[model samples]
Target: MSDVTPDQLPALPVTFRPGRTRTVLLAAGTALFLVITLIALLLEHLSPGERISFVFTAALLAGVLFLLARPKVVADEAGVTVVNIVSRRRLEWAEILQVHLRPGDPWVFLDLSDGTSMPALGIQPGIAKRQAIADARTLRALAEERSTAGPGAARG
Candidate 1:
């Protein structure tokens, strides 16, 4: 066991912002699933078993996909966590090489030491520009601070 005091660690920055694309997709998918299920239920020509199976399968698949498509971003003084619609990746502040705010880019990206880039789920294309920029700035600042502080200064 290691003796580490919480105060010795820098506080984590609040970096999460809701993803508009995800919210819109989830809403549309849910609506479609419900409408299809209702139609399958009302149509009499379809076999009872087939109708039930189709509706259940469609609803289940849509729900799962929608859940998976939800994007999330988390940042602590120690690192940043990005979870995309299909994938998730994390980078410690020390590993972050750069944070850029590209005007037309769909999302914020973190350049890593290995020359690979990871998307920041906090800024979604469909969101308001001002809000996205604000969150981006906050994330960038936190990453910069941690980077200058050096590795092992803050561990999570």
Candidate 2:
């Protein structure tokens, strides 16, 4: 492994991560996790079952918060995958009609050829405006290049 050069490594998918502000969620989740752990430990009077419940609830809350901070969009030669807090979606190049990142929008929206639109929360604006826009453009370019159907088919 030490002899391997960078070029020998497999191409990595381009991943767009959430802005810095999202770190607050991670910190807050950690704090909550710690606090709950402490509380559970300190509550010596509680039954074993109650203690277990407390710890479980704390873990669940922390997990949700941490997951919320993990929204991301990954793109590769094949297609794009969007991972949000509660759900994930995969779209092939031909399925995407356009990539929209207009002002006033919270995040990039993928307008699909199916006449439905899905928000790519991974490439959000606000804190990371320029990066988000660039990522959107990259997605659009990929869609245009990879789709077998001409762009005109989806423009309408």
> Highest TM-score among the candidates is held by which one?
2
Candidate 1 TM-score versus the reference: 0.75
Give the per-residue lDDT digits (tens) of candidate 1, residues 31-128.
87888888898888999998988799878878776865577778875677787777877778788766666878887887887878778766755556
Clashing pairs in 1: none
Q: What is the lDDT of residue 55 in candidate 2?
A: 85
lDDT of each: 0.70, 0.77
RMSD after CA superposition, every candidate: 7.3, 7.3
C-alpha positional error of residue 112 in candidate 2 after TM-score superposition, expressed in Å: 0.7
RMSD of 2: 7.3
lDDT score for residue 39 of model 2? 93
Best by lDDT: 2
Model 1: how far residue 42 lies from native, Å: 0.9
